[model samples]
Target: MSSLPDGVRSRTVSTDRLETHLLETGRADGDPVVFVHGNASSSRFYAELLADLPDRYRAIAPDLRGYGHSERRPIDATRGLRDFAEDIRALVAEIEIEQPALVGWSTGGGVVMRYAIEQPESVASLALLNPVSPHGYGGTRRDGTPCQPDYAGTGAGMANDDFIERLEAGDRRADSDASPRNVMRSFYLAPETELDPELEDAYVDALLNTETGDDYYPGDATASENWPGVAPGEGGTNNALSPKYLDLTGIVDIDPAVPILWIRGAEDRIISDTSFFDAGYLGKIGELPEWPGEDEYPPQPMVSQTRAVFEEYADAGGEYDELVVEGAGHSPHIEQHDEVLSALTAHLDDATTRIGNS
Candidate 1:
């Protein structure tokens, strides 16, 4: 490799359905840990962090279809968090691992969030970094909104040039208006960050060889359900709180059986599955923490802020723990790699330890 550190030896586990990709290291005999990436990004986000982990962790970070190394198009048009879990299940079956720890970032958090709830057997425990969900999952978001796009109309393809142009334009506009600093809460925001290079290349390869490089999860279905009172934008606006409450409190009810460890950055902006904020969250990578004695100004909870929600969850003793990464923005793994790893290692060890004891 170039001046950048050498990444792990990875492979593509292709089933009859999809070819899963990963950046792996650690001993083969160690407990298998699967890493899931969030929306707008891929497993590539974890490259540096995984590369630096201890050798005892057999980590497998996969690019969810459409985001990373995996083929994107012709995917199940009905793809949802559960569909992602199915992929993880298939991967587990492929490796014949009895129990593997699950780790997800942002949208990937939503995936594992659903997985542990629906199929607890697959994940021994979870580590969610800067996770985004409209509902305060682990004190992330509590308004009971789901962030996704309104794929109701002409969602011809994930990579449809015209559609992509529109999407990119909207994203750029949102970024410009809300400010990249504000949107940093959504995912890793390196002043010079692009899609994971390897996964991006792999996607290009797949796009050239595959039939469809399109997104299966329609924006129409997922976007409308955002921060409780936030309405959909550019995509549409059906964001009235009452209907939103019914959709959240009644529709996709929260399950509390699964254990969660959430790492909140001092500055977190993006709320997952909830399109409450414009792509530009609070006009910064995320919201800054308001301390007790920092500003003479009185502190109040940030409106539609994910950090506030996550803190609330911790107070409720929701089977979860939260950490604040000082100086880290949206993607703590990038901002505080070592600290993030320490937190993850601790949680995973606890998970396998409990599993072994039980």
Candidate 2:
């Protein structure tokens, strides 16, 4: 466990799969709420959120395998997000948590969605904060069909080399735009939002803890005929998230659908309809070269795809709601803390009531 803020304590829980590191708040006897963090970030990212939760609920945020202080386990990208979902399952079992509300942010949201799909009976509720598309992050259309059979335009090939180098070196100097610190400042919040220097530094430290290699962060790549010239190479986090491997749109088929709360920053650029990071969008905007034109290589309709899936889920008798925080970016919980907290608290309460009634 690493040093964390007051009220947020760290501990290790041994699961059948691995020894997981977690940051926890609230009371041991309280209802459980598991928080799953996104890519490149550790459980520490949720420290403030955990501490702010009502005392009746125990807030626990665990560092996913291969990230933060967790064991550096081999990630089988072909399993899609199953590795992460199973890890969460094992953690919940080890902790003896029952019917815990699952909260996921960014890629973490994808993990929770898979969890709900695989173990619908175990989940009490779900909250997705700027989650990746249900069809996966990239290499797909609005309907989740791969643009190419090889799933190009995604995976490790899409990651910026300079950014990876800066992250690996723990580059704190904001001199270069590719520096992790600068990237976080630019993309994690709205431009006008003022960040506390110390908190920002802590968040950057969490990002630096990410393991970078062909087996971890960005994964590996292979040659392709697509405009990007590369495709997912079978393993690592990014590859696991490629449309070739990940897809949760079938969550609408979950026998007993879990209640869901979809909250996101309206101005989020990372997981938006035209994500700034998506190669197709970058190419269309002349930030990248040789886009195959919109018909052949359109920018991924991330938000639209997610909305469509949730719409189907709702039509299938699942309860779902949406909240868009104005002027926020990828991280609404941090940028618009009070509003997110209030909404989450209310959602959790409603979920608890619903579960109790059932």
Candidate 3:
């Protein structure tokens, strides 16, 4: 593993399911806060954030299975976010963390949602940072309905071949459009914002740790009737995030609902209503050719779907707060650090109070 930023220490925790690699900071006996990272990223992404956490909080960021230095466990995509959630559950149990607050970013948000749904009593609070939709990533309508029963235009096939190749080869070239480094700069943060060389290098290193293959990064694919002509296959990272496998809309039914804090970047291109990563949107703009009209296959309303689910959760007695970081992109934590820190600290404080009362 590369050298972590100041105050962040690298460690491995052996859970019943898998041996997990993590970066941790703050006091070991302090309030537990677990940070879950998203796709193509690792715990290293939270190194600075964890290191800067309040002294009273024990912040830990684990590299989910097959990412970073963790064990390369085969992911069962058909299980949706269960594999990741179960690993988190086991890790928390093994570490004896009691009602830890979960902070999930992007895909990690989906995992934490699943964790909360499956084990609500174990969660103190939830902080979703530009999370994927409760209905999953793609192939869904604004009302959270699937564009097709098979969930085409999503999963592994949606991944760009050149991008995956660059990732697999650990390409660090900034010139190539497919390079992970370029992708991070273009989509992870505001395009005009310059990244510190050290931070940029570290971020690229973390991305390079992603395991790429039919059973990992992009996963597998199937034939499709959708414009993309590809559907979600049975297994892998992308498949795991497909709507066919992941759906947390049932969260409204959880008894004793967990408090939630939804933080998003106002300029996030990856999770927006017209996300550039979404095939339907790409097709609509003629980037993918042969778009099957908006009515038949509209772009997945990522943010709207999240709002609807959270609205339902609120109606069911769950409380939540949404904060939009203006001018930020997919990674508001990095782009708007001070704002994110303040929001997270406040949310954690509330979570502590809630847990105390409960």
* lDDT, candidate 3, at 252: 83
Query: Tens digit of lDDT per residue, candidate 3, span 76-169?
Result: 9999989999999898889888989999999999999999998888889999999999999988998888887788898898999999988888
* Pairs that collide, model 3: none
lDDT of 1 at 75: 37
Cα lDDT of model 2 by residue, 219-265, tens digit: 98999987789999877999999988898887898877888999999
**TM-score (all chains, Cα) for each model:** 0.64, 0.98, 0.98
- Assess the local accuracy of residue 256 in candidate 1 as a C-alpha lDDT between 0 and 100: 38
Show model 1 residue runs off by greater than 4 Å. Answer: 1-4, 74-79, 134-187, 190-258, 272-276, 279-318
lDDT of each: 0.51, 0.89, 0.90
Q: For residues 13-109, could you state the per-residue lDDT of candidate 1 as single tens digits?
A: 8755568776787888988888887655556667777888778889888766554567653333333345566777777778777678888876676
**Can you rank all candidates by TM-score, best first?**
3, 2, 1
The pairs that clash in candidate 2 are none
Model 2 stretches with alpha carbons more than 4 Å out = 1-3
Q: RMSD to native for every prediction?
A: 9.0, 1.1, 0.9
